[model samples]
Target: MKISAVRGVKDILPEEVWKWQFIESASRRIMENFGFSEIRIPVFEYTELFARSIGQGTDIVEKEMYTFQDSKGESLSLRPEGTAGVVRACIDHHRLQPDSVSKLYYTGPMFRHERPQKGRYRQFYQIGAEVFGTDNPWVDAEILSMLHLLFEQLGISGTVLQINSLGCTECRPVYRKALQKFLRNEQASLCTDCRRRTAGNPLRVLDCKRPDCKEATQSAPSVLASLCRDCMAHFEMVKGTLDLMGVPYEVNERLVRGLDYYTRTTFEILTDQLGSQNAVAAGGRYDGLVEQLGGRPTPAIGFALGMERLAALLPEETNHSRAKPLYLAPLGDAAMERMPLLLHQLRARGIPVDTDYLGKSLKSQMRQADRIGAAYVGILGEDELNDGVILLRNMETKAQTKVPLEGFVDQIAETLAGEGA
Candidate 1:
């Protein structure tokens, strides 16, 4: 009987793992360059944490979260997103004190119980970053600028940057009331889930993707039109800063994120290549979440990029070609026995090298070397051994040379360096 992986889960084989590595390395480098320290959070947390933070009516909380009871009957859930866990960590660690700012980044898997599609998965990875302790619109601008730099470094262009203001508590209730009225009137046109959400979280109805829902909400009251003076000013400054920094963006009047905590600035980087679920990255400001989760009042903002989508969008040439490795073909048992030390010496010096340990034929080993993309092949047989030398062949040029085996490790190392291997 054969056992297979669970449905909706995937194994990232070595050939495809390089793309993930490239994305992670590039993300880490860019985040560090912007002074964001890395932070790791637990894969699962108390279910209440998400319910309290992501809004109980949201799809992520109501339908997508993988919730279960622990041995003690306490509820626990695999995280559906990164920001809530990050905020919980900050609060638990007392890192959200007055006048102190915390900038952090994380990369890992998140779980959801939903139909798996091209880019959306029940278990998927995300690269996210968060900034806490300030509501300055300049920070929002800086965050967007950092994201812009990341996409540019990844060589991904033609992505549209859409921005919107979700207003603030002071004035959002008015917009919420107006939006609820509008949605209630269009109930026949809304989806079942959206109809249930109309009274509790009307803003999310505007973010719906269904044709009927989108059409019904197209003329829905604009949250931007109802922004309080302070919220309007903050949104303006964010745009002004972006203009000063040359970050192009579009103002979407109905671009509310699918989270309850978002307020003021919300944005997403979209590309048409990924179908309807086209957002590669999205986030916004959540100035009230820190306090809502039991911490003293604090301001925070962050964004998460879908790892699967980002890897899919990565250019074909980026990180696709690796430095060719050195292949050691030891033809006899005696030659095989001597390879470990030589292999270690070369590898320890940062040279990529490998050798056959299966005691295969010279021709078979050479074929293996070619299959593995080796740039140079070192062949040692009876003739070469008796001559006290090793035959080194440049796989690319088919050039062969004999080198004394007495100090072969150092000699081969020098020759490889000289040949720019």
Candidate 2:
């Protein structure tokens, strides 16, 4: 019998993991600069947490979630998205105090049982950020700028920003009624799932990917047309800020994001490079989410991007400068005994160094070192050990030098510090 990986999952091999490291590191640095702190939530949570926060009618709750019952008969689910979990954490921890704003970021795997494609996976990684306790549009603009800066820093080009206004509680009900009436007229032309959405979350019908549903929704009432006075003012402010910052965007009225918690100032960063799944990152405001999760009425905005998609868009050879080891190859049993001490000395000075424990011949050790791409190879033989000296061979140029072991660590440190390695 043979065992293979689950159908929609993939392993990140060593060759591909550096791209992940680069993306994650870049995300952390950018978030830190924007005054957002890191927040980590559990991989699984009570099933009710999602149903209430993401809305029972949304596709994520109705179809994609990985939910099950624990031994105690309590239902649990692997998180399908980041916002619901973040809202739960904020409410549970009381981070939404009356007057202060809280900015937080999270990175982890999200599970969804969906058909996999080139840039889509059943289990994927997401880097998300959420800000609580402010209704100001500047905060929304700042989040957008931060996401823009991240893509720019990564050298990821050809991305366009699509912005929209879903309106707040004051206007959404009016639009929902109008949208339902329009969908009712086109019911026969809609897909089965969209017909259900018309009854549950009519707004989600606009986001459906089915060709028939897309056609049916093309003439549906736009949420923008129904924006109340307060919502219109807020939307104008967000747009004005983006213009001042010179961030290019388009007002896309049909872009109702997949999740149900969002409200006002929604946006997505898209690139044509990735074929059907072109959205690299997306997010928007959710002013009512905190209150719905049992906290006080707190206004929040945030976004999340798939790490895998971001990595795939990155140039294949972008992160080739990561620091590696200075290999130490001891040629004889006598020199091998002193290898540990030498390695310790180099390590103490903060030098990344490595040596093989297997009793391989000198030629084999050198070959292994070369394969690992070591910066330099230090050859220690019986004579060199007795004479208190070691030989250094530059891997790139194949140049050699001999130095006394008494001050070897300091000498190597100075050389590396001076960029002579």
Candidate 3:
């Protein structure tokens, strides 16, 4: 019986992994440059954690989550997103003290049981960043600027940044009520999901992708129009700061993100290259989530980008070229005995080196080296060993240099360093 991978999951083969690594490393570099440290949260958490943080009415909590019960009769679930688990960790560790700020980023796989399509997978990876303990709109703009810098550095073009305000606790209800009332009148035109959301989470109905729902809600009450004095001013400052930082964005009044925890400002980076799944990255302020999850009242905002989607958009030229490893080929048993020590000595000096232990012929070994993209091949045959020398061949230029065995390790290191320089 041929056992295959389960459906909805994908194996990222070696050929495709460079794209993923390039995106991840670029994200890490941009994040660290902005003073954000990396945090690794668990892949699964107590079911109630997600239920409490992400509202029970949200699609993730209601349908997409992968939930199961343990032997102890406790329900746990694989995380569908990173924010809830990150917030849980911060509160659990008492990292969110009054007047303290923490900037954290996480990258890992999130599990959901939805039907996978072009960039969506059951086990998908995300690179996300979060900032806590600051309500200042400057932080919002700074993070957006950081994202702009990341995409610019990654050479990913054709992305549009859309921003919106979801209003705070004090003013959201007013908008929600008005939007709900408008949706109730157009209930016949909405999809089944939008119809159910109309009463419980009416704001979500406006975000529905159904053509009918979009057309029906074309005149729906805008959340931006309903923002209170404070929320409006905060949003204004966010936009002003973004302008001052030279980050281009459009104010999208209907851009309420999928998560229920989101409060004031919301934003998404959209690319038309991906069909219906246009949002490559999305996030917003979730100021109330900390308190909602048993922590002191805190203000925070963050965003996450889908790894698969971003990888797909990356061009071939975006991958940073890497120095190839040096391949070691030994011709005879006597030469093989000396090669291991030489390899160990060379590696201790920080050279990327590899060898084939199967004792293949010189021609076969050279082919293997070429197949692995080796830049240089060090041949230690019995003749060279007898002469106290090793024949080093530059695979790219086909240049051969005879390195003396007495101080061959240092000589090879110097040679590589010179070439690199």
Top of the candidates by lDDT:
3
**Per-candidate count of clashing residue pairs (backbone under 3 Å):** 0, 0, 0
lDDT of 3 by residue, 89-191 (tens): 9999999999989999999999989988988899999999999999999999999999999999889999999999999999999889888889999999999
In model 3, what are the clashing residue pairs, if there are any?
Answer: none
Off by over 4 Å in 1: 188-193, 210-215, 419-421
The full ranking of all candidates by lDDT, starting with the best, is 3, 1, 2
TM-score of each: 0.95, 0.94, 0.95
* lDDT, each prediction: 0.91, 0.89, 0.92
Clashing pairs in 2: none
Q: What lDDT score goes with residue 398 in model 1?
A: 100
Measured with C-alpha atoms, the lDDT of residue 411 in candidate 1 is: 79
lDDT of 1: 0.91
Please report the TM-score between candidate 3 and the true structure: 0.95
Preferred candidate (lDDT higher): 1 or 3: 3
lDDT of 1 by residue, 1-421 (tens): 8999877889889989988998888889999999899999999999999999999878899999999999999999999999999999999999988998889999999999989888988899999999999999999999999999999988888899999998888998888888888888899999998998787777778878799899888888788889999999999999999999999999988687888899889999999999877999999999999999999999999999998998889888885677789899998888888798888888888888999989999899999999999988999888888898989999989999998888778877787789775
